[model samples]
Target: MSATPPPYHQTAVRPDWRDLPDGLREAVGGRLGASVVAARTATAGFTGGFAAVLTTATGARVFVKAADLARQRHLADWYARELAVLARLPADLPVPRPHWALDAAGWYAVGLDAVDGRTPRLPWDPAELDAVLAGYAGVAAALADPPAGLTALGLPRLADLARSDILWWEEVAAGREPVPPLIPPARDRLPELVALESRLPGYAAAAPGLAHGDLRVDNVLLDPAGRAWFCDWNWLCHGPAWFDLAGLLITGYADGAGLDAVFAAHPAAVDAPPDALDVTLAALAGYYLTAAGPPATADPASGAGTVGPGAGPAGGNPAGTSALLGAHRRFSGEQALRWLAARQGWH
Candidate 1:
């Protein structure tokens, strides 16, 4: 079987067993009532911190993750949000079950049911895609309305991204940010592009139910039973149910899966808002175009690396820069934008 690149790339640094703060580990132990026998480190996630499945004294397994808020405050905070989101998800949802969480002295960690599975590799497995779509269908069914505490928890709305997340293309077009030569053709049509994207918030705001705001390959795991479980609930939101499906379509497009072919078989994509695929693709294009082809202020990870510093509201790049990271974002963004344009008939 040929392997395509992973749907998302995680090249950020992660700490090993020796690197976690003493309090965080102790807190995990205290909550589980098990002595930490070994830390099986994980390297797939992008947050670039500590993530592992802990083996307890009694041979019990619990998934545990911790991040340094002081160094990467936003990512750490997002990890904290996962604890909150996990606590309230329905029992049947295909996600890790949350056991406990800890936030002491700025270091945060959470323990979850260790899932026995693997993130699916690319070239799109039919069985795996079918399983994941079924999982998404379940999520859509369960979250047709937001759960009781989810709204009160104050999760972000997709409309909130209009100014912040979707306007990137416009910003770079106007020369506010430096432009990179490797960009989408849509940038040249800024007014039209901006107007097209501006319409998304209304569509997004009118979304029927809660959405997994970030749904990509890296954030998913396929179990031995061929079931799919979505990870990383930090970007959870109240939005259109089909949003994740749209992202998947775009991902398919990027991976040479034949966008129409992916959509024809995906029931959720078939049932989503008529214009959602185009709009969501546009939104993705706008978001990625900003980082991929800009004056390098920060690195944006399309599926490989991330802006870490220059990509979001979190702040600027503190770690200086990495050419490899930038190249990944730029390339991923370029492809995503192009795909969006084709979907929109902008070409």
Candidate 2:
């Protein structure tokens, strides 16, 4: 395994929710009742802006997502689509009940039955980890057969997306501005990165299934009873199961041994193709390279401050980019590179 990279900053751009339009407040009050109190922003990072807790007069707490209207229409669209998908899911699925949603005004708000639980911290117990993974597997199984009349979520297929990501990295290596190093090795091994792109299609065709495109621990909530409620459906799409598994493992959940245990516990995921892992690493790399940057106060609509000014705030801070890239290297660097090398066919 390659040595892990150094720590980097994780600066996230947060939008002030007090800046939301008055119509949005009226819409929430009308739908959720007049006594809705808006809480501070709960999430900070990436597009779609941030989330605030809306407490109703009846004490019902809902989450309101205010997105960058211009740059992240996809997030607003995803929220609506996810609502539809959640509505079709089995009533028994361990997910938050979608009470209501408003898609207009560049805001996506959904009322969820609040689960009184904290985000599980790292170095989790084996039992707890098993429960979380099992919960994910259960959700995937329940939604195994998507409902009819449902259009495929417009997310790019994972393998194809991975190939595209590697090419982007190569472009960065070729001195493309604003495409700095998330993981420096990616720049050092441009040929291998290119190879990864070529070999992706074969793997993509071989294993196809429903996947939670982003399945990190942060997106899941584990209740006191040990059940995990997966949230953040912004990236759900059709892909291999291993893509999800690899995401879980690579994002600092399980190591090689831990991943083995997860697979052993859930035999249904046994046949998850290796390419799924490759895509997972590639996706992580691509996201860091593309989205991670200095805190951009730029409205996503204007696309200004999208990358921020300077080589990032101060000092040699890599911020979100380094943390993300370091995670990939620490958890799955060899696997990531092997996938890249296989694609490049440059031994």
Candidate 3:
């Protein structure tokens, strides 16, 4: 049998913008103008960084994101890289227009033209889901072969990243902290995952493509016209095309029959080669389990005793957290269990 999963603290922590460097304000004002009409917090449940909506005197609106420099430098680099990627994409693609990026002092900021839209409620209609998926697929098709000289968003390849992610889960499972029910199964599934990894390279070699590594419902923006635009390219990288489709299927769509319909709709399009599906499923499992498990005090960005069980003033929304955990349980629990059972040589 697999070892007991590690104990974890699941909490939401909001970063204080008051401590943000003055240079960030100066940079924002300099680029957009000194007339800062209004500033307000935008979203509620992100764990990586803080976000705000800034309105200038001229009525121009921009979304500013302040990421933790001490905790994740790669994320900062991704902000810069995303700007370049947006620049490379055809102007017509349904993506936010990145205005400018600021990397001053120890903080990093990215300003993008705020799209007028909102996140649709979960259990979306069939047409809505199809539209979102189609939009994403179109974007991928457009950038089928990335332009030359474009730097990757500093994200590791899928195979390598998957392996590292598994090890991280393993470490968390073996840690002193309490492991949530969702994680033990993920830990147990490592061997088959390892076996799948060995066979992925060959399939990946067939069609090397670009993917928006994180394509959950939250990252997608639906405008008043029902158009969908993707944001948050921090985890962007080159990998199997199916990786992106799998991410959406596993996280955004429902499980069981709903999931079967999604695959049925896009026969060859969503059918990943051999173990590619497993790798993607395994990665998704690890992401939610780790994201839901707990906060690490040592992690200044997400792990500081700011959010999770027994969180302080800046902790996350309990209702939202409960909803997220519930969704993860619905779609990912079986995969997590299968992963765990595989470790024990269970058929």
- Scored by lDDT, the top model is 1
The C-alpha stretches of model 2 lying farther than 4 A from their native spots are 1-18, 38-40, 68-72, 103-108, 149-156, 163-193, 253-265, 274-283, 286-347
Candidate 1 — which residues are off by over 4 angstroms?
Answer: 1-10, 104-106, 183-187, 252-256, 264-267, 270-272, 293-306, 313-315, 318-328, 344-347
What does the lDDT read for residue 2 in candidate 1? 12
The best candidate by TM-score is: 1
**Candidates 2 and 3, the one with greater lDDT:** 3
Instruction: In model 2, state the lDDT of residue 73.
Output: 56
> lDDT tens digits, residues 48-123, model 1?
6678888989999998877676876766677778888988988788899888777865787778889888877654
Worst 10 residues of 1 by lDDT: 1-10
Give candidate 3 regions above 4 Å deviation: 1-19, 68-74, 103-106, 149-155, 166-198, 255-257, 267-271, 290-347
Candidate 2: residue 109 lDDT (0-100): 61
Q: For each predicted model, how many residue pairs clash, with residues at least 3 apart or on different chains?
A: 7, 5, 19
Residue 218, candidate 1: Cα error in Å is 0.5
Deviation from native of the Cα of residue 279 in model 3, angstroms: 4.3
Task: For each candidate, give its TM-score against the true structure.
Answer: 0.84, 0.69, 0.71
Q: Using TM-score as the measure, what is the rank order of every candidate, best first?
A: 1, 3, 2
Candidate 1 lDDT (Cα, 0 to 1)? 0.67
**What value of lDDT does candidate 3 attain over all alpha carbons?**
0.56
